[model samples]
Target: MEAVAKLNNYPTSPRKMRLLADMIRGMEVEKALAQLEHNPKHPAVPLRKLVVSAISNWKQKNEGGDESTLIVKTIFVDGARTIKRMRPAPQGRGYRVRKRSNHVTVIVDTK
Candidate 1:
């Protein structure tokens, strides 16, 4: 059985979030949370929270289950809506700036 958690419209680029997601994929749940907690990355904070939430969700779904055997089975980040803004440039020109967002899905399962 697997437990899944999703975070949508996260205000970070998919490329940046993928770096952290790749590290936790296939790792033990406890170890993954620890890594995210210690890592000095903006996205890691929310990722850790999502993992904790997933753990609780698993517990609620499966009564009398052991959490120690849980592992981060799959995690992925995908591009989401982009916010576009205009930045003032030299010579009275405007430059388009794209603020990217992403959605992340994490699935934890018993090993």
Candidate 2:
């Protein structure tokens, strides 16, 4: 059995989020949370919360299971809609600015 959680439209680039996700992939839940808690990364904060949420989901699904055995089974980040804006450039020209966002999914299962 497994549990899944998702974070949608997170206001960060998929590339940035994937960096943190890769570090925690296949790691034990408790260790991952501890690593995320102390890591000095912007996206780590939200990713930490997402893991906690997945743990909660696992509890709800399995009434009597050891959480220590849980692991980050699968995780992925996908690019979301980009917010486009115009920036003023020299010589009365305009530059395009894209604010990227991403959707993250985490699936946890017993090791």
Candidate 3:
């Protein structure tokens, strides 16, 4: 059985989140956590939390099951709502500033 967790509207670009997702995809739960813990990327903090949440969810579904064999089965990021703002330009015109956001999903299961 797979356990799932998600982070929604995480206030970062999907590409940025995907980089970390790629780094941890198909990795064991313990190794992923270790990698995320030392990662300097801003998204790593929330990503780490998301993985922990998945572990907790797995624990809930399979009571007393050992998590040592668990791996990150699948993880992905999708673009979310973008916040657009206007920035003043040199020619007295407004430039559209897009603040990208993303939703991340993580699935964990036994190897």
Candidate 4:
């Protein structure tokens, strides 16, 4: 059985989000949750919520199924549209600043 959850346009770079994603990529549901809970990274918060939502989705899809055996089957982050802004520079020129965003997907399945 599999369940999926997605977070879109999260205001964080894919590189940073991937760090957390990599940490819990193949971990068990319980262990992953614990790891997220203890992690200080900002991305960990949404990732943890996504995992919980995925687990809830699994439970809904398979009534009476146990969640203890669930593992994060796949989790990936992709780049989203970047917002560009101008920052004042010393030479009367505006430096382009890119505010990055990302989309994250999590797939959970029974181990």
Candidate 2 local distance difference test against the native: 0.96
Model 2 TM-score on a 0 to 1 scale: 0.98
Please write out the lDDT profile of model 4 over residues 23-45, one tens digit for every residue: 99999999999999999999899
Q: Local distance difference test, per candidate?
A: 0.95, 0.96, 0.97, 0.95
What CA RMSD would candidate 1 show?
0.6
C-alpha TM-score for every candidate: 0.98, 0.98, 0.98, 0.98
Off by over 4 Å in 1: none
Model 2: residues with Cα > 4 Å off, grouped in runs: none
Residue-level lDDT of model 1, residues 1-111, one tens digit each, is 788899999999999999999999999999999999999989999999999988988998899999999999989999999999999999999999999999999999999
- The CA lDDT at 75 in model 2 is 93
In model 1, residue pairs whose N, Cα or C atoms come closer than 3 Å (at least 3 residues apart or on different chains), thus clashing, are none
lDDT for position 67 in model 2? 92
Residues 12-88 of candidate 2: C-alpha lDDT, one tens digit per residue: 99999999999999999999999999999899999999999999999999999999899999999999999999999
lDDT of 1: 0.95
